[model samples]
Structures are given as C-alpha cells and as structure tokens.
Target: MTYTSLMFALFCLVLLLVYYVVPKKFQWIVLLIGSVAFYLCSGVKYILYVVITAFTTYITAMLAHKNKREFSEKLPQLKETLSADELHAAVKKNERKSRAFMLCAVAVDLGILIVLKYLDFVLSNINTFLPEGSALPLFSFVLPLGLSFYTFSAVGYVVDVNRGKYEPERNFAKFFLYLTYFPQIIQGPIPRFEQLAPQLFGEHKAEYKNLRNGYQLVLWGLFKKMVIADSVAAIVGAMLKNTSVLSGLELWLGMFVWGIQLYADFSGGIDVSRGVSQMFGITLDINFKRPYFALNLTDYWNRWHISLGNWLKDYFFYPVAFSKGYAKINKYTKKKFGKFFAKTVPVGILSLILFTIIGIWHGANWGEVLFGVFNGVVILISTLCEPLFVKIRKRLHMEERVFFRIFRSVRTFLIITIARVISLPSNIAIAGSMLLTMFGIRSSGTSFFAFTGQMVQAGDLKMYLPALFGCILLFVVSFLEEKGNSVRDMINAKPMFVRVAIASVGTVIIILFGAYGIGYVASNFIYSNY
Candidate 1:
C-alpha cells in the first residue's frame, strides 16, 4: 500500500484502467472495493479496528446530535419560570452528557492507538517493577497501517459534529470512505471532513487537467524520495552509526544533510498523496511550503508540516487559550504586569503546553517529548524577543535592508536545524549527547575522511551523485513552483509534441535511474508512523 512500491503502482494502473471504463455512477463502487482490497492486502486483522472506529464514532456522533436537539427543545419551556438553580441544574445535566459522549469518542480513538502503538513500551516499564519470577503475559500486535491518521480524522469528525461545526454523517458508507480513502490512508496531509467529504460524495468526472497535473506531481515526488532523500539517508546512516569516530565538522554536516533528507522524504510522500488524490478529482491540503526559507521560528512553523501545525493550532491551542483558567491568568497578568505582558506571556505558556502534548503525540518516547519541548521553547523565546529585535533593528535603521533580511533567514535556518536534532533522536540522553558532541566538547580530532573514504570505496559514492544532481533540480523546480509556475501549467503551455517528448523522457529516466527493484529497499514514508 506504500506509494513508492511496485505493487501499489501496479494496483493504481489497474484501478485507473477499470475506473475510466466504468460508468461515472459506479466509479465510487470501484474505488471502495479497491480501498477494501488495499486494506486486506495490508493484513485483514486490522480491518476490524477500522470498522470498530468508524462505526463507534458514527453512532456516537448521531447520538450526540440527538441529545443537543433534545436539550434545545426544552430550553424555551424553562426560559421564563425557571429559577437560577433550575437553569444551572438543567445546563449541567446537558453538559455532562455532551462531555461523556466526547470522552467516549476520545477514549476509543486513544485506546486503540495506545494498544497498537505503545503497549510494548508500557508493559516493558511495568515489568521492571515486578519480581524476576513474575510471569506476566506478553503479546505482540501488528499496528494497523495508517491507524494514527484515520483515527485522528475520525475523532476530529465526531468532535466537530458535537461542536456543531459539522452535522453528523447519516450515511455509514460515506463516513467510512472519509476515514479510509486509499490515497491518503498510508500517509496524509490529514483531510478534514468539511474540506474532503464533499468531494468524495459529489460528482467527480475525470478531467484532463487533473490527470496532467497529478502525474507531474507524482514524478516530482518520486525524484525527491527515490533520488534525493534515500541517497542522503545512506550517508547520514553511516555518520550516525559511527558518531564516536566522526569529526565535529562531519557531525554538523551530517545533521544538516539529515534535515534536508527528512524534509524531502516527508514532503515527497505528501506530494504523491496530494497528486494521487488529485487524480481521483479530490484536492488534499498542501503540507509543506519551503519551510527552510522561514525567517523566524514562528514562520518556520507556519511553513513546516502545514496541515498538522494548523490542526494543532485549531483543536488544541485555540481551546486552551480561550479556556477559563487561561482567561483568568490573562486577566491577572494584564492587571499586574500590563497588557503587553498579558497578551504575550499567556499565549507563550499555553503554546508551550500544547507543543509538549504535540511532541508526545508523535511517539511513546521521552525523546519525542523533549523534542516537542525543545521546539516549544524556541518558539516561545522567539515570540518574547521578537518585539525587542524589531525595536533594535528600527533603532539601528536596518529594518528594511536586504542584508538584514538574509541574515535573519540564515539565523532561523540554523536554529531550526539544531531544534530538529532533538526531534530526531529516540531518547533524551542521546539527543543531549549529540548536541554536546556537535559543539566539539567531546571531540577527539579523529579523522572522518577515512570513514568517507571507506564509503566511497564501497561504491556508495555512485548512489549519491545522482541524488546531488536531483537535489539541485528539486531546488530549481521548487523555486519555480514558489513563483506560481506549476508543472502542469508549464507542460500545457508547450506544444503537444513537446509535452509528450518531455513526459516520455521523464518516464525513461525514472525507469532507468530510479531506486527500486533488487538491491534497494524503498523505505516507508516516515510520517505514516505518526
């Protein structure tokens, strides 16, 4: 089911052929069957999890809507004669029901996630506290592919229904399709119900424009993942494995390369997903937008992982900011420390907490928690200092200078690189050690050239040259894309023969030079695990 796999490519080709041949009305049926088949190939046992989640949330959302309707009906009856106590009691009862329903939805989603993803981690910690003779039962469970993604979408759907942002989906099949859409199932830009469901349920006639645009996007994504990210990974893997033997300069270089590798690998997957969805006449949200070009920590967040960042801001940050506790704190700070302090400090503190939760949401490890906190701290510091920095720049008469802007951009990139190191490790101890080693405090001046020489001797150097060329190409293409020149538009502007020639050449290059088949194992998209 992985986008980069041969099997998936074959499956897509077959599906496309069948889809265009079928009547438009029956096309959805074909897609649904294909989705189920895809899930079955992933392993059948996990289908139960998907069914359980979809059904449970679907029913719960309906019930929640019914309850809200019932409460609203009684509100007018009690409006005039009801005392303050009676009104309070009635409101409290309704609130309790709403809270209970929400809790059930959250628990079901989180419980499945915990059992499938973190049960082993939890049990291992508990086993340490038991005696040696203890015979605690241990079992292994295969995590459902895309469980983290679909579950969140499902949960968000139910929550939105309860909040009145969306009406409950009355049709079970439509709801299921929303949760298990094949293209976005494995990795996602995590579609929202309001944004995506309409497209799925509405009329979708295949368009030549969608096909041309989508195919180009898929090719761009392949170039990034197969040609660029994978090659960088080989180099990074060698350096990280022998960190003890690497020079300080080598370590820093590896970290920088790793940042690029991760971005290409992840954003590449997103591009393919978006393209595939587009081919099906659905438009998924954009995920990344030149994050490295950001001029500040705040700007970096806005560009990087755009979907997840916005999701967190909407579902977590906003609620906490407007919560009673936060409101009280804001009021207190305003009265005591002034409006400027209140406006910034409350948001920074709340953002720190939300980011910490975001980190833990990524995994069941302390490393991820630390990573989240590291990012939070950087953003928080930047928020507090931004005003002062702006004042200083204005005072120095450097506010609008190009050089100052370039310096800020470089500074932001470096800060992001350091912050991402903490995010990549498996444990806080390793992350901290890596940071220390990166600073040259643990340096022994050992030669890293010898290791690089060995890599070259082993014929790994050949794999990297194409990737370097690919990276340069990717940069140029991205620059063009930033300027609003889409691949499809570029192609369409050319003569018909020219378009065909370019596509034929691109296909030949991919078949000959792309990393796949024997001797190469295509790695799964990293974000899929989340």
Candidate 2:
C-alpha cells in the first residue's frame, strides 16, 4: 500500500492501535504479521520473492557462523598435532570453504534480482543484432516491490558475517523481520543487520510523545508529497509531453520544476517511512542531510542520499580503491609521476566505476548508464582541476568569503540540474533534444504563455498557487535545517494552544491543497520504481 493513500492512513491508524494493545512481548510478532500482510496487499505472488531473499540469507549466514565456530574449536587441536606449515594449510582450506559459502549466497540473492530486473533489457538488446526470424522471445516477469533494496540488504548482511563484522542471528523469525520491515522495505536507508535487528526484536510501548512527534512528521511528509510534489508534477508532465510546442524559457522552467518534483517525491517518501517507524519507537537512519546547501558536487552527494553514499564507500569504493591491482598502480604512478597524481588517479578510476554501478542499479537502460557515466565524468573533471581552482582562489583571495560560498553552492546546483536530464526522459535522445531547446538554440516557435493558458483551461490552474506556497514552505524548513535548527523540535516547544493551532492549519492546508482525491489521479512515489 502507498503511504500517501487514504487507505494506507487508515491501515496505519488501525495497526498502531492493535500494536499498542497487544501484550508487550508480542509486539514484534504483530510487526511481522503486519509486514507480511502489507506485502500481500501488493499481491500474494510478491511475498514469495521477499521470502526467498530472507530465507536464503538466513540459511547461508547460519552456515557460515557454524563453520567459523567449528574452525575456532579445532584450531588449537590442529596446532598441537601438526607443524606450522600443515596448520596454515588446514586453516587455508577451511577459509576457502567459508568463502565459497558466502559467494554462493551472494550469487543466488543478486542472481534473482538480475533475472527479474534486467533479463528483459538484456534480451531486447541482443535481438537488435539478430536476424528477424531468429529473435528470442522476451519474458514478462513482474519485478517484486523493493527487490533491489531488500536484496542489497540481504547480500550486505551475509557478506558482513563472512568478514566477521557481526554474529549471525540464531532465531530465524527475527532475522527475517530485519529484511522485511515494511516501512523501510518499500524504499530504504538500507539498514545493516546490526543496526536494525535489535530495534525490530525489542518491545516498544507506545509513548505519548512518540505518537505526537511521529504523527507530526508524517503530516509534514504529506505536505511535501501531496501539496508540492504531486502538484508540480502536473506542470512538469504537461511541459515534457509537449516540448515541441514550448518556448526555450518554458523548457528551462519545466526542467527546474522536474528537479523539485523528484526531490520532494523521493525525500518526502523517506520522511514518511521514518515517521511511521518512529511511532513504533524505532529510529531509522537519516537519509537526507540538507543536500541543497552543499557547496560542491561531492558535498551534495554526501548529503543527498547519505545512506547510499555510505553504502558505496563501505562496499564498493574502499575495496576497489585499495585492491592489490590499484595498490600496484599507486606505487608505479608515485614513482614515475608525482604524489598528487598517485593519490588522485586510482581514486578517480574507482569513483567513476562506482557511479556507473549506481546508474545501472536505477534501471536497465542505456540512458541510466550514460547518466551514471556523465556524473562520474563531471566529478572526475572537477577533481583533476582542483589545483587550478585553488591557485585562482589564492591569487584572488576569494575562497573564504560568504558570497563566494553562496556562488559555489549555486554553481553546483545548476550543474546537477543539467545532469538530471539524462534520467528525466524515456530515452537519451529526447533528453538531448530538450537540452538544446532549453538553451533557445532550437525553439518550436510557440509562445510560452499560451502553453500555460492551456494548463488553466485543463483545470490545472488551481495547482499553481498551492505549488508556490508549498515551495516556500519547503525552502523555509530546509533553510532552518541547514542552519542546524530542528523545525520539529521548535514546533514541539511551543505553547499547547500554539501547537494545536499549527497542526490544525497544516492539516487544513493539506486537505485543501493536496492533489489526490475522487477526481484527481493519485500517482505512485517515483522512487518506488527503483
């Protein structure tokens, strides 16, 4: 069930009531049932997919944990009975067995994801090179909801066990709960087993403060999604669908609006997820960190999707950058060129590779691949020119000024907005054409105001004022957050009458301004596709 729907709101309210009334010890069981029921609502067949992932990770991690325990018990016996070389060989053999188990688990988990998500994309591409009569038939497999997210979580869990990061869970139900937590399973911060497991299993009696804060955040998230994101989506949809009839100014406006739509939709979803979990007294990791305030592309990435950034750094970047192959390259470059070159080249290569993987993870399309590569290229170019930038800044003594920092942030935002086009359209060619039209180099001769007038006649004129008000609300909240102020806490600190007044006004705004109801078509959260 989508978080934005009225049905989902009623579901949460009922679940919260039952959750609190249950005996304290059975709260976790209540969650397990609720989670499974939630998935079943999507489709009975979909539950099978998540079960496969959860079961595979559970069995493999237990096996690895058992092997490690056995090996440790036998090590002392082997040391007493054998020479140093024999002991070393015995240990190596056991390590090989453990590694094989870990690899098999990872392959099965990721293999399922690959076949369901990318197999069709792969087959369609292969057919392009084949004779018409010899083309392969495409398979129509329905991808399970949040397949990428839960698969990655499971794979990371088993791998971490192999690396001796944490002991595996002995209880199967608890372990499965870690993988299937409903709020995060839909779109995630992709919690590590160690971080999320305890919270899932422990009892949490509903507290008044927790309830108040949780509902507050959920309402705030609704404001961002329904009032701002869905409202702007109408204009963005109209402009993008009729780019051939829009002026250069209108095209640029559409692009800017799309960026806002995407941010509101994705981050707003996360806020709702976190708020729901918070009601149960479980605190999920923070995913966004005031990304718009970042002064560089790297800084923006660090803030934008904090969980994914940390995931890549831990799983992909550090391993590839520090691998033996890169180690050799590092030494050779340092000896032949200079320290600066040695330090930058290896990291730059791995950073590019990481972005490519990130892009492909979004979808099985060439546009996403190019989108990833484009981001990598920009990041690498900036890194390579840092010396020149530093030299210019030093000469002008402009680096430390407040105005200069603001300019840097604006520059980075524009660069990211341009890069957003790759994934905005169905194909790369359309995105490229849109960019050309946006620059006034290739207009279709339609007046900008005429297209906007069409929007009015189509009953979308009512959305504009609400969109503007919502955007201003977003800016104010984001600015306060950027300055290290907690807007939620500030609200909570007000007088009782004031708090009620604020909540009443916010709810009224959403009821009147929201874009979903009987006549309006409710849209799925955008990141739900990923």
Candidate 3:
C-alpha cells in the first residue's frame, strides 16, 4: 500500500497497536508478521524474487561463516606447524576462495535485479540495430518492490560477511524481516546488517520521547510531500506539457522547481521511513544532509543520497580504487608522468564508474544514462583541473569573499540542474531540446509572466500559496540544520504546552493544506524509481 493512503494509515495503526501489546519476546514475531503482511500487500509476485535473493544469500553467508570459523579455529595449529611463508600462502588461498564465494552470491543477487529491471532496457537498445521484422520481443518481468535497494543491501551484507565484518543471521525468518522491513521497503537508508540487526532482534520498551519525535517527523514529512512537493508538481507538470511554447527562462525555472519537488519528495519519504522506524525503536541511517548547501560536486554528493554514496565508497569505490590492477596502473603513471596523474587519474576513473552506476540504478533509460555520464564527465574534469581551480581561487582571493559560500552553492546547483534535461526527461533528444530552450532557444509570444500566470492559476493565489509558504518554512528548517541546529531538538527543548501547541499546529496544517486526500498518490517522487 502507498504511504499516503487511508488503508496504509490504518495498516500502520493496527500494526503499531499489536507490536507494543505483544510480549517482549514475541514482539519480534509480531514485526515479522507485520513485515511479511506489508510485503505481501505490496505484491505477491515480488515475494519470489525476494525469497530467491534472501535464500541464496542466506545459504552463501552461512557457508562462508562456517568456513571462516573453521579457518579461525585452525589458525593457531597452522601457525605452529607451518613456516611463516607457507602460512601466508595458505591464508591468501583461503581469502581467494572466500572472495570467490562472495562474488558468486553477489552475482546471483545482481542477476535477479538486472533481469527484472534492465533486461528489457537491453533488448530495446539491441532492437534498434535489427530490421523491424526481426526485432526481438521483450522478455523482462516487472521489477519487484525495492529491488535496487534490497539487492544492494544483500550484496553489502554478503561482502561484509566475506570480509568477516559480522556473522550472518542464522534464522531465515528473522533475516527476511531485515530485508523486508516494511518502513524501508519503498525507499531506504539501506540498513547495514550490523547496525540494524541488533535493533531488530532486541526488545525495546516504548518511550514517550520516541512517540514525540516520531510524531513530529512523520507530520513534517507528510507536510513536505502533500503541501510542497505535490503542489509544485502541478506547476512543473504544466511547464513540461508545453515545452515547445515555453521560454528558455521558464524551462530553467521549471528545472529549478523540479529540483525542489525532487528534494521534498525524496527527503520527505525518507523522513517518513525513518520516523516510522523510530517508533519501533529502530534507527535507520540519515539519507540527506542539506545537500544544496554543499560547496562543490564532491561535497554535494556527500550530502545527498548519503547512504548510497557511502555504500559505494565502502563497497565499490574502495575495492576498485585499491585493487592490484589500479595500483599497477598508478605505479606506471607515477613513473611516466609523476605523482599527480598517478593519484588523480584513478580517482577520476572511479568517479565516472560510480556515478554511471548510480545513473543506471535510477532507471533503464537514455536520460538516466546521460545523467550518470554527465555527472561523471564533470567530476573527471573537475578532478583533473582542481589544481588549476585552486590557483585561480587564490589569485582572485575568492575564499575571503563574503558571498563565497553562496557563489559555490549556486554554482553546484546550476551544474546539477543543467543535467536534469536527461535526468528527469529520460529522452536524449527531448532533453537536448529542453537544454537548448533552457539556455537561449525560445518561441516568440510565450512570455514568462504568462506562463507563471498559468501555473499560478488565474490569480487565485491558492494554487501556489501553500507551496510557496511550505518551501519558505522548509528552507528555514534546512538552513537551521545547515548551521548545526537541530530543529527537532529546539522544539523538544521548549515547555510542554509549547511543544504540544507546535505539534498540534503541524498536524492541523498538514490536514488542511496538504494536497493529499482519500485517493491521493504521488507519481513524481524520483527516488521511488530506484
């Protein structure tokens, strides 16, 4: 069920009631049932895919754990009996086998995701090269819910287990709950096995603080989605509808709004997930960190999609960057062209790979591919030219400028926004045209004011008022956060009646100004595609 629906509200309410009422020991079972029920509600068809990943990973991890345990048990004996060189060789052999096992399990899990998400995408590209009469029919299935999320999570867990970071969960049912945790299934902070497992299995006594914080978070998230994101979606949709007639200024403005709508929708959803999780005494990772306030692309990435970025850094980037192959390449470069290329080339290459994967992870579309490629290219260029930039910055004394932070943040936004052509539009040609129109290409007689009038709905003001006000409020909250003040903490520090009054107002505002109703559903939440 969708989060905004009446049915989901009732479902959450019912589950919460049962969760706390059950005995402490049985509380986990209640969560398991609730989680399974939630998954089944999403779609029974998805169950098989999840089971395949879960079971395959489960078996692989159990076997790997066993092998590692045995190796640990034999280590002392091996050290005593074998020479140092022989012991080192034996250790390397064991590591090779463990790596192989990890790769095999990861491949199986990734294969499922590829088949369901990208098989048709691959076929479509191939069809273009063939004659029309010989075109292949598509053979892909519908993607399971949170397929990207869970697959990465499963792979991360497998890798960690192979590295002996943590032991695998022995109980399959409980393991399944970890994967299918209802709150995170839609979009996730992508829980790591270690951080989340204890919380999941441990019994938690309900606390007033948990309820208070959760209530505030959920309320704020709902308001972001319903009041700001959905409201702006209408305007952005209208602008997109008449791209042929819209001016360059208008298209760019629309892109700006798209960024806002995207942030609100994505971060809003994560807030709900984290908030709901808090109520259960399970804390998910933070996904966003005032991304727009970031000074540059690298800093921007660190703030946005914090979980996925960290996952890639830990699992993908480190492995590839530090691999023997790249190390050799770096050594050769250092010998040939000195240390700069040796250091920066590998980083540039890895950034391209990571961001491209990120792009493809978003969707199996040309736009997404371009989105990844565009970001990668920018990163590559920026990395290569960082020394030059540093020189220029010093010459201009830019760091000392009062508006330096504003300038850098705005520059970062503009770079990312220009990439939105292929990102949100998905069609390469259309995206190119939009980019053209966004810069200087425009039709005559389509004034920006007229377009704004249309979006604002004939001077009614009600159409844009809530979104404008909501965004102002959102910016204030985000600004405070960027300044190291937690708005939640601020509210919590207030007197009891004051906190209650604030909560009451937040709830009432969401109920009154929110665009959601009995049948309301969101379609433009970008991350949901991933």
RMSD of each: 2.6, 1.9, 2.1
lDDT of each: 0.79, 0.83, 0.83
Q: C-alpha displacement of 386 in model 3, angstroms?
A: 1.9
Cα TM-score of candidate 2: 0.96
Candidate 2 per-residue C-alpha lDDT over 122-196 given as tens digits, one digit per residue, 9 for 90 to 100: 999999999989999999788887888889889889989988999998888877778878888777878888888
Ranking by lDDT: 3, 2, 1
lDDT of 1 by residue, 1-530 (tens): 68888788888889877876788777777777888888888898889999999988988888888898899898988777799899989888987797678779878987898888778767876888999979466566778878888988887888888888978889898888888889888877778999998887776777898887888788778778877787777677776566666666666777888888888888989888888778888899998988877778788778887777787787778978889988999999999999889988889988888778777777777667776887889888878888898899889999679798778878888887787677666666666676777786675356423334322333366667777888788778777876688856777899989987877876665555667635876678877756
Q: Name the lDDT value of residue 319 in candidate 2.
A: 73
TM-score result, candidate 1: 0.92
Q: Give lDDT for model 2.
A: 0.83
Residue lDDT tens for model 3, 430-490: 7777776666654425654345445445222464788899999999999998889999999
In terms of lDDT, model 3 sits at 0.83
